[model samples]
Target chain A: MGVQDAEPLDVERIREDFPILDREVGEGTDLVYLDNGATSQTPESVVETMSEYYRTYNANVHRGIHRLSQEASIAYEDAHDRVAEFIGASGGREEVAFTKNTTESMNVVAYAWGLSELGPGDEVVLTQMEHHAALVTWQQIAKKTGAEVKFIRVTDDGYLDLDHARELITDDTEMVSVVHVSNTLGTVNPVSELADLAHDHDALFFVDGAQAVPNRPVDVEAIDADFYAFSGHKMCGPTGVGVLYGKRHLLEEMDPYLFGGMMIKKVTFEESKWNDLPWKFEAGTPPIAEGIGLHAAVDYLESIGMDRIQRHEERIVEYAYDRLTDHDDVTVFGPPGDDRVGLVSFDLDGVHPHDVSQILDEHGVAVRAGDHCTQPLHDVLGVSATTRASFYLYNTREEVDALVEAVDAARELFAV
Target chain B: MVGSDMYRQQILDHYRNPRNHGELEDPTFSHVGENPMCGDEITMDVELAEDGETIERVAFRGEGCAISQAAASMLSERLPGKTLSELREMDRDDVLDMLGVDISPMRIKCAVLAEKVAQDGAEIYLGEKDLDRTSTE
Candidate 1:
C-alpha cells in the first residue's frame, strides 16, 4: 500500500505545548518516545494546572468550611463533569468517581459490586486480551465469591471473538469485563456489541478504557457499558488519578468501595450511612491536584479535539504499517486492517523482542518490549513477547520513521 | 559500531549456536525459571554423576534475548564439571563476569536468567538427593 500524507494535526505547534518533546536524549538525539501505552507526558497547561492548585487552593475538599476548601472542591468536582462529558456518560458528573488509577477503578467495581452480587456457580466472562488491571480484578472477585471465571477467546486475526463472547456470556454470567482496545495488539473490540450480549445474558458489562480513553472517543452510554475505567496519566493528565464511570443506578446501589472520612454520611458507633453518589466510593483524601490537572488535560484535549487526534494517529498508523510491512524482516501482529488503534505490535524475524528493543533504545527511540501485560494473548499469538510502538497525539511521522529505521538496523545487527 | 555493541560478536555467536542446548534424557534435576516481566524462559536440565554432586551434563532449552540465550550457552560451557556446591556459590557478579561485557541494570535479568534457572534446578537436585538419603537411611 502506498503511504499517504498524515492527517493535519499541527504537531509542531502541539509539540511546543509539551516541554519534554524538546528534551535531548542519548548523545543529543531527540527523544522519540513511542511508549504512550504506558503513560503520556503532560503538556505545560496540565503542569501549570496542578501547580496553581497547590500554590493557591491547597485544602482538603468537602469538609472544610473555608474559601480555599470551597474553591478546591468546585475545581475537583468539575473534573467529574468534564470526564463524564468527555466519555459521553449521560448521567453526567454524578456517575464519575475518582481513584488512583484504572487498576483502582476496576478493583472498586469488583470488590464493591462483584463481591456483593456474585456467588457460587456464577461466571465472570473476560476477553483474553485484557490487561492485568482488567483481568486480575475479576479473578480476585471470582476467588472471593466462588464465582467461576470464563474467557472469550481472542480471534486468530486479533479481535475479541464476538462468536466466542456470545457463548461465554451465558445466563449464569454475572459480569463481562473486557478492554475497549487491546493494549498490546491495538485491536479495538466491539464493546457495544459485547455490552449488548452481556445485557442479553443479564450480566454487567465493564470496559477497561485505559488504552482507549486517551486514543479515541468513548461513549459509555452509547456503548451501554455498566462501567468504564480509564487512567488520567495516559491521557496527558497526572499519575495517581483515574476516573471510573458507572451507571448512576449502579453507583447508587453498590456498596461503598472505600470507607472513611469523606464518604460517610452519618456514622454512629454501630452503623454508618454512606454519602451520596461518588463521594461514597472515594474515601480518605482524594487526589485533589491530580483531578484538577486532569480537568486541564481534558480542556487541552478538547482544544485539539479527540476526533482530530484519532485521525492523526490513524494516518500515522497507516504510514507505519506501510513502512514496517515493506521490510522483509518484520511481521506486524493484530487484526489485518485499519480498524486498530495507533499502535503496532510486531517482531523481527530473528531478533528477540528485548534485543530489538535494546537496539531501538540505543538509537534513542523508545518502545515497549515484553508480553505487555497480556500474557495469555501473547501465548495465543505463539510469541513469548513482542515489541510494540504505541502513538499518541504528540507522536509524529518522523518518530515512526525513526522506529522503522531502527527496527531495520536491529534486523541487520542480528542477521549474522 | 558501538551502536550495535550490546549485541557483540560473542553474544551473537552464542545466540546463533547456543552450546549444550537440548533436553537431557532422564535428567537428575530440572527446573524452568521465567523472567515473566520480559517473557524470558530458561529450562535448565542437569544429569548428575554417580557421586550425585557433580553435574555430569548440563543443558538448557528456552527462548529469550541475546543476553539470556547467550548467557545460558556460556553457562553450559562453564558448568559440566562443577559440583553442586560450587554451582550454588555462583552469583550475579559471576554471571556478569562470565558474559565478559558490561550489562546494564535493565538487562541484568536477561543476562542472569539462565543462572537463576540453573541454580533453581540444582536446589531441587539437592532436595531430591536429601529425600533419597532419608528414604534409604
Candidate 2:
C-alpha cells in the first residue's frame, strides 16, 4: 500500500476480531475498551495460532524425534527468531529467552546477574516511575546482597529526574535498571541516554519494555540495552509468555536461573553442565502454545508496520490530550506534548477516580482506576490513584470524544 | 447480571450529595483505612457522648470511588444512633446489599472501604490498637 493510500485502521473490523468486546455488561452499551496498557485484546489471528498449535503440533518441544515434536520445536524456535527480529536483536536466535511474563524475565536478571555482580556497598539505580515488578525484584536483591538501591526522583511533571539519575550513578553502581516508559504517566524515558551514562560508569543497563514494545518500535541494538524485558499479553498476545533479551556475552557469563530437564546439556550423578544461551535460561516445559501466539501477534504488528502503529497512537494521544485539557475540571498528567504514547491518565475535580471509572463503565467505557502499579510515583504526586484511558490501533478519536462526554456526565452527577 | 437498576436511587442520592462529608470536631476516635491496591483512602472519625458507648456523631473525609463515598455517607447516617457493637458486626455484603447492587468481585473493595474505616474507628474507640481485628470485617 502506498503511503497516502494505506487504509486507516478500521475500528469496526478490528472490533470484530475481538470476541470479548461484544459482550454487554449493562443495557446495550458497546464496550469502549481503553485499557490496552493493562492488557490488550488479542486478535483472531493470534488466538487461532495458539489453537492450531494445540490441535496439530501438540507435543513437548525439543524432546523427541517424532514429526509432531519436530514441528512443535520448529514453530517454537521460529517464534524466538521472530521475536528477536521484531525487537532488533543482533545476537540472532540465541539471545531470546522465554519466561512466564515480564515479572519472571526481570527476576531472572535479579537472580542471575544481580546475585553474581551486586554485593555489599554496591548500588543499583532505579527510577521512581518503575512498576513494582522492576522495583520489588531489585529491592529483594538489595536486601539479600546488602547493596544500596538508589532511586532517581521524578520531576513534578512526572518525567524522570535526570539530574538525580546523574548523581545516583557513581563508580560503586553495579547496574541501572529503568522503565522505557512510565506505565502510569505514559512518559517515554530516555533509555538511550541512560544506557550511555550507565555504560560510562561501567554499569550495565536493563530496561523494562513491557509498555514500550506495544506502542513503538523497540530496537534493543539501537538502545544498546545490556538486558531488556517485555511481556506478550500487553502487546495483543496470550499470557504466560514473555521475552528476556540479554547481550550474548552477558548471558554466556551468567548462571542459569533454574536447573531442570530442558536446560541441561548433560547430567551426571555428581555434577551436571548447563546448556548454552536461551535454553540455559528456560527450564522444564515452556509455554510453547503461548510463544506461538506471540509469534502471530508479532506478525500482525509487522503487517500494520510499527511506524504506522506509532503514528496512529501518536495521533490518538495528541487528540485525547487536547480534548482532556479543554475541560476545566480535568487534570491531565505527563508531558503536554505528543512525546508520549497512547496512554492518558487524568483526574476530574470533585470526583474520585473510582467514581469516574464507575460512571464510565455505565457508558461501557472501560478504564483503569488505580495507581497503575507505580506506587512511588503516586506517592510523589500526592494522589492515591488516577483514572487512566489508554488507546490502541483499534481506538479512534470518536472514542476519546465518548470518554470526554462521560467525564462531563460524571462531573454533573457528582456535583456537590 | 445485576439489573439495569443496580445503582439504587438511594445510592445516587447519597453520592450526589454525601452527608457528613466534612470533619468531626475533636473526635474521640479516628482511623484511616487505605486500599493499597487501588489507592482508595477513607478516614473516619467518631465522637462519643460522656457514656463513651453510644456514638454521638460520625463523619468521614477521604477520596475514593462512588461505591466507597456512597457507602461512607450511608454508614454515617446508619451508625450515628447505633451502639458500637452493631457497627463492628457489619459485613461487606451488608454494605453492597444496602447499596442495592451486585458489584463485580474486583470492585468489592470499593464497596467495603467505608466498612473498613468504621471497623477501624470502632476498634480504636474501644482502645484496641490492633488493626488485624478491624481488617477481618
Model 1: residues >4 Å from true position, as ranges? A1-7, B23-30, B46-57, B80-83, B128-137
**Candidate-wise lDDT, in order:** 0.87, 0.86
DockQ of each: 0.55, 0.47
TM-score of chain B, candidates 1 onward in order: 0.88, 0.85
The B-chain TM-score of model 2 reads 0.85
State what share of the real interface contacts each candidate retains: 0.75, 0.64
| Model 2: docking quality category | acceptable
Candidate 1 is scored at a TM of: 0.92
Instruction: Identify the candidate with maximal DockQ.
Output: 1
